[model samples]
Target: MRAPGAALEVALQAHPDDGFLLLRTARGAGGRPQDVEITWANPTALRLLGARVAPPCRASDAMPPDVVSQWVARYEKAVTGPGRSWTNGVHGSSGHDATGSLYSAAFFPADDGVVVHLRAASHVMSALARDALHDPLTDLPNRRLLDEYLGMALTRIARHRHPVGVLFCDVDNLKWVNDRLGHAAGDRLLRHVARRIRAAVRDEDFVARFGGDEFVVVVQDLPDLEAVSALAERVLAAVRGDLTLDAVSLHAGVSIGVAVATEAMTAAQVLSRADSALYRAKRQGRGRTRAFDTALSREVDRRLTLEADLRQAIERQELELAYQPLFDLSSDTLAGVEALIRWRHPSGTVRLPGSFLDVAEETGLIVPICEWVLATACTAARGWVPAAGPRFKLHLNHAACHLGDGQMTAHVQAALDSSGLDPGRVVVEVTESQVLTDFDEAHTALSALRALGVGVALDDFGTGYSSLTRLQRLPVDVVKLDGSFIEHLEHRDRDRDVVRSVIDLSHSLHAAVVGEGIETDDQQRVLRDLGCDLGQGFHLARPVGAAQVSAML
Candidate 1:
């Protein structure tokens, strides 16, 4: 019979994928095997290890630290134990090649010490490459692959002089689906939409997931602008109609923004224009397509400039809080003051929250802005004298995004602690539509706020799709009736009935009902008769500066 070392040497010499190494145990103090020395290596082992010199070198010098440590442990076990063979997988630079390839290493006891057989894992490398370029959920190309594909399409456009069309498709009502049906259903909906979108576009056209409910489709060699528009329409039609997820039927729709590449445009520029158009389509009502044009380009530029300015507006002292007083309807006494933010633009005009809040929320600038608001509002409330009314609270409206992360409670606590204001006198208000996006998360956040002795109010109630049962489940001390419900209270029976039911329900739940937007005396009278605890609007008080509010108090 052939010797084990000779057999291994003969068997692996011509092997293409396997590498073999013969190692002798290197002992230290007390005869413990501390390391190993490479006595012999096959041609494949030398190539894989990127070893420049021949064997008779220390394993530490021949392999990476991690690989050497692993091999040393296996060598000790093979030499000292029952001579049982061992096999395991490892990942590191093969030879000096730093490619970090995966390998399966098998160990066997040898006459001198141990022998190791290594096999390259080419299939695992291919899978890793595939995962890097594609979305695991939808199995579609991701943004990175999209960029490369777009680059190729742009190159084709440069060579052939044909326009490349890019469509930015955003799923509509996805937040609603996620909120009501759960995220698992939302993911199923996304996968379903992905299938429809892929089926809609031509095989040559590239479709990629661009993160969150957004997808990008690139059509190469488009003849004209009309072709882009037609493709957008096809995508819209493809993703529309009813789809069932988790046994619940949902109407699916997407808003598309179309941009045709110009000769000088880069990938980012094209995508930006398409995104701007997509926002326009969403604004114009969803399930529609809008093409990028000069008007949209100008709008995008203006928005970018505004966003940049808003970033500095806080440091420049351009942002200020306007306090609007909420009244106790029964005695016509001031119950509280709601702090509303206003931007005194450098252009000599006062901008309402409506003018720039959307931008702030989208840019994630709302967090800092809100922090500033909390500090300022708390400090202002702390300055109020006995005349401000001992029981009057300070209400501050918070964006849902600011409150969702479980950090708003800490922020509010910090503001209150710094300003030495009573948490009992503070009420944090969140809009109904915003709160419904993630009700459980909102509830947890609100519960934490309430635990701190501050009150929580569901603002703009009846504006959202939440039912009375949902309202009953929320942790709130107050419910602010949406202005729409109170707008036609004097003339519309439906509005009056809805307002009455909301107040009755709120009161039964031990929550105060505040009627908002009381423009006329009749609205206030009806609200008071319906047992609304408080009211706020232009008729009672317009939002004013801190000085004005202090003076009034």
Candidate 2:
């Protein structure tokens, strides 16, 4: 029976200001006791306002000092009419030092003499705010809190104000921890974050967790980037302390990104710069700090966007394949076509593999992208094979991870059969890196494809890890020399020597070599004279779809 009222009380306590809104009030001085006062204000604000807080606290207590001034200034206009005037300044907790977040304000009646009404609802509001501003597990401020502080801090410093330093830090692979140990263990690691973060910064400096394992330290009154860098180093040292997980000694490192407050920037701009610097440090092999710079931000941002764009492309199904002809150098005839995946965006722009393939490889989307490319290319090949002539080939590059895919062998067989293209007419090009990463799987897949009577080419041969070693054991039939090897033909001592060795190596292994990037007749003549068996480049024929190939053949 008491539960109903208790719940009501809890609700009211949660948002005392709602009482004014929920309870009907009379106009002017003749109103009832509760209705006469504002509803949201509560004991907390009443205390802050230097008044004894009463039952059914009014909502007016949320007003801050500045807001109270505005109200008092506008009191004449408000009391002369019916509607309440919204206060501007919020009343904040006395506990707030410089970095504190919650600031409460109130709605007050226009009359100067009208009693101040405090609402109990601000407590509820404050609780909700605290939750939103902080990470649940670590109870540390997230990016939002950092933004508010950095904004105010910079604002204060604008009029020849004091200097400030910020340390942006990231955890090295919390994902690995979550995967290997468990969420509990990951939470435990994050729980110890504050102490380590604090230990790295001075008492006067500000610290907050950005998210997951990333944190930021904003230090006011810093002289320059050098001082800021010192804080980053300290943060690295502090977080790198050995951690014990299930009786195992584990070491964790902090990749600190630092951005100092500047007069020309907003809070968002400064933090963004710091994030860029942090990325640079991570790229430099983690466990260190890098100062923010414009060039660094651009490169990091470009790579970051490329990675993100590649992932989004998969979800959006925004990829296509273009066919480029492989020339038989001796006959000057188109022997086969390389099936290169291109990102044809919904936005109507086309991008080459170089723009995003590395991102695909890193994020493991290479497998799916490769799968889509092979299937689509084979389908197109089937449509044009009869008209384009017999034994025309579509060469598709496979990634290091694709070999490990359980259904890839099946995917290949299906693509070939469905397209009505013979397995012999399709060439599976495996990049050197792919073969090295999972040798056993690559061997198995290649052997299976060979059994199906498909042609397989080892791509970018000289660039892979132990290419020659792989050749001896793998089921490779052709070797496509990477373009990097072809770039060095002019210097015989270095470039020519490397090319000669690779050619000799490929020949010794009995694998036909295809020189890529033969843009000029000189490059082509030189490559063919050097005993290269096949060639591919613009000078032969640029990559084109089936329609264009119709005219060429």
Per-residue lDDT over 1-553 for candidate 2, one digit per residue giving the tens place of the 0 to 100 score: 0122233345456555532221113245353222233333334444544433443433244334454344443333334445444343222222221234333333334222232333444464777899989877777777898889888888877786676777888887676577667888877877776778887678878778887777888888878878878877777788887898767567877788887776757887788788878877876878888998667767767877888877888888887667889887888877778887788876789998777776677667777776677778888777767766564677877665557665667778878877777787888888787777657767888888888888788887778656466577877778888888786565455776766777787788786789998787778887887888889988788888767766666
Specify the poorest-scoring 10-residue window by lDDT in model 2: 89-98
In model 1, the clashing pairs are 48-95, 49-95, 50-95
Q: Cα lDDT for residue 518, model 1?
A: 91
Candidate 1 lDDT over residue span 68-150, tens digit each: 77777777766666526433222222222335655666677655557777666764476688999999999999999999888
lDDT, residue 354, candidate 1: 92
Error of 2 at 522 (Å): 8.0
What is candidate 1's local distance difference test score?
0.84
Worst 10 residues of 1 by lDDT: 87-96
